[model samples]
Target: MKTLNTRLDNAIKKLYTAFHNNTLHPECCKQCAVGNILDNSDSWKHFSDEHGSTKLNYVGRVNEAFGKRFNGYTPSELLQIEVTFLKACGYQLPIHYKNTKPDTPTDKDVLFNGLQAVIEFLCKLDNNLNVMDYTKIFDKIKCDFIEKSPVK
Candidate 1:
């Protein structure tokens, strides 16, 4: 079995390799990338308020249950993974906004525009590119180890 560090290094290597060799497929058309997730985010925020306070009062159970210090994946990483699939079917994604400024796109403003682009691109993938399949592979990369120290 590979050590956690080795596994992490390999994962990072793959991410980097994919980055360096990023290949955009032919143009497909506009579609949703994370339309479902965005839609669910609303439902979750609403449900947590009205009937189930589960998500709102996540407190600490979420950490124990999901095994993360906080939210598991970073914005860019998440966006990248979302794009990877739809790109396989020749979809062009909008440049992700990664800034903090209100009026301008920042180097770190990875939200709305990024999400919109991803969704649009995703709406065009071939039926063969199972979203769940790519999701599992991406999840594995993010969840690579059983933390060395649980109480950090």
Candidate 2:
């Protein structure tokens, strides 16, 4: 069994590669955040009927009931992570073209923001700090976790 840190690290690496390679897509199950975390598998999609919905379907409920952990995340957690990613990417839930979506789905900045959101959510699941949050490094005081950059 991999530790939470190890799993999260692996997920980040996978997402990094996908983002740089232009393989990450909000509509593609195999290239999405949860999909990449699960080794590019689309199996996690069965957890919900809608792409950005956190509501579990029958498959999800059964798996959750069995205490199944897909790549160290439960079905509910997977949905949450996907929702976080999609929402950060500027999609209105469930992902329909008629709804809302990024002007360019493959745009680097958009994808980076989505990835960042997912990473934060993943860390939160384990009650851990976001690995990508560098603000902590400039913490003049422990209470100043949200301090602005010293450069400005």
Candidate number of the best TM-score: 2
> Could you tell me how far off, in angstroms, the CA of residue 12 lies in candidate 2 after the best superposition?
1.7
True-vs-predicted CA distance for residue 135, candidate 2, Å: 1.5
Encode model 2's per-residue lDDT on 1-152: one tens digit a residue: 13368767787788878988888998889988888889889999999998889999999999999999988889999999999999999899888668989889878888999999988888788777788787776665655644644754
TM-score of 1: 0.22
- Give the poorly placed runs of model 2, Cα more than 4 Å off: 1-4, 139-152
**Steric clashes per prediction:** 12, 0
| 1-152 per-residue lDDT for model 1 (tens digits) | 12234323333333323324431111111112222233212222222221211233343334335643212232332334345533432334432234122242221222334433443333322212322235677667666754543666
Per-model TM-score, in order, reads: 0.22, 0.85
